[model samples]
Target: MTDVRILGTGAYVPERVVSNDEVAAAAGVDDAWITAKTGIRERRWAAGDQATSDLAAAAGRAALRSAGLTAEDLSVIVVATSTPDRPQPPTAAYVQQRLGATGAAAFDVNAVCSGTVFALSAAEGVLGRTGGHALVIGADVYSRILNRADRRTVILFGDGAGAVVLGASGGQGPRVRHVALHSFGDLSGLIEVPAGGSRMPVDETVLDEGLQYFTMDGRGVRDFVGDHLPRLVKGFLHDCGVTPDDIAHFVPHQANGVMLDSVFAGLDLPRATMHRTLTHYGNTGAASLPITLDSAARAGAFTPGDLILMAGFGGGMAAGFALVEW
Candidate 1:
């Protein structure tokens, strides 16, 4: 059996920095309240001309460069995003065009915040079958889908992108030891964009009610993660033949600081192993894990042979864990 490994990682955030004060004003809240509630100081917003694909391309190029490969060497491009250039063509098509990654199979995954993990699963499968590199990019232009006036939702999101290059192993970065994914379709209503899909087509009615904007049941999501995350992490570690303290790094979805604190409170985890970027990026949805991972890597936090665990939770209400042997 071919062993799939992540060769390199990269990330990108738009240059437009939106401070908590700025967003707070629009949401009719104080900057301190936003920080206290979400532990987010600031986040990046994609420019009007920027789309999910553009962010994906920048991340992909950097990832390929890190891996010493190019777009032409890729066998597949799997993009995980809820925001796209348009609803017609898959976002990966535009990413491919921007990266000049011709002839690679391209598509998008929409597991919401669990998207990148889902995309990684797809890329791992492709690499396993074809023995070539696959670029898995998780990029989202969430600011475009949000209601700026809704403090409950707008305070928790930002736009960003992250990518990883996965291929058949040659004794490189991290070997993909295991990946487990779960979804609670019944909880899908806990987080969603209520309209613009085939079921709720975009119309004056939808627009009038702001149905096109993103919405989330914050308390409900918190309850779900609190109940499930610890168990999920423990299970993943157990299956990987280790304990909570075994992994050197734990990269979880940057959903929110308070939510993360609640989830980890119940787990028997080593306090120092967790890595987070949410204080700066807010909840970047699908891009959270990879972006955090890349940040840690660039900071010289990872060492060869270290165990790295990535866990994500969000809409579908999906959750997944990927154990990496770094």
Candidate 2:
């Protein structure tokens, strides 16, 4: 079996910074209240001209540059996103065109926030057989779909993209040791964009009721994470033939700081240093995990022999984990 490893990572968040005061004003809450609950001080929102594809492409370019490869070197391009440029053609098509990755097979994966790891697993599978590099990007423009008045979600999301280049092992960087993906279809209702889908096509009625905006049962989501995350993490580590103490770095979805603190405590990874970018980036859906990973990588946080665990969980009521040997 061919070994697939991450060659490079890159991330891009919009230049426009939306402060807690701004989000608080729009959501009818105070900055302190918002910070106390979510531990987010600010987030980036896309400019009017920017879309998810644009962010994805920029990050893809950066990743390619980091890997010392060009778009022409790509064998596959996978974009994991829910807030795509459109519903018809997959967003990866736009990304491929923008990056000029003409030779690469492109597609999109919609596992909601777990999309990053899902896409990573998919890309790794393809690369294992094809013997070339793959570009995996997780991007979202949640600001476009958010309801400013809905405090439950508006304050928790931002716009950004993160990407990685994967290829055959080169005796450097991080090798993907194992990956696990799980879905809880029974709890799908906990988070969603209720309209603009086949079942509930957007129309005047939908707009009037604000059904096109993102919505979530905040309490239900918290409960779901609390109940499942620790168990999943434990099982994933066990299957990977490691223990919590074996992990040196932990990068997880930038969902909520308070919630992450609780989850981190329950996981019992005493020796692991938890990495977070959500204090300024907010929860960027599928983009969170990779974005955080890129930040840590750029900061020289990991050593060659270190173990890094990346976990992503979100709507679809899904979760994905990847064990990386750094």
Among all candidates shown, the one with the greatest TM-score: 2
RMSD, candidate 2, Å: 0.8
Which of the numbered candidates is closest to the native, going by highest lDDT? Answer: 2
Regions more than 4 Å wrong, model 1: none
How well does candidate 1 score on lDDT at residue 194?
Answer: 95
RMSD of each: 1.1, 0.8
Q: What does candidate 1's lDDT look like per residue over 1-326, in tens digits?
A: 46888888999999999899988988999889998998899999999889889999999998999889989999899999988889979999999999898978899998999999998887888787787889999899899988999999899899999999998855766888889999999999999999988999999999999999999998899889988888888887888898877777778899988877776667777733788998888889899999999999999998888888898889999998898888
**In every candidate, how many clashes are there?**
1, 1
CA-lDDT, candidates in order: 0.89, 0.94
**Tens digit of lDDT per residue, candidate 2, span 1-326?**
46888899999999999999998887899999999999999999999999999999999998999899999999999999999999979999999999999999999999999999999999988988887999999999999999999999998999999999998755677899999999999999999999998999999999999999999999999999999999999999999999999999999999999999999999999999999999999999999988999999999998998999999999999999999999
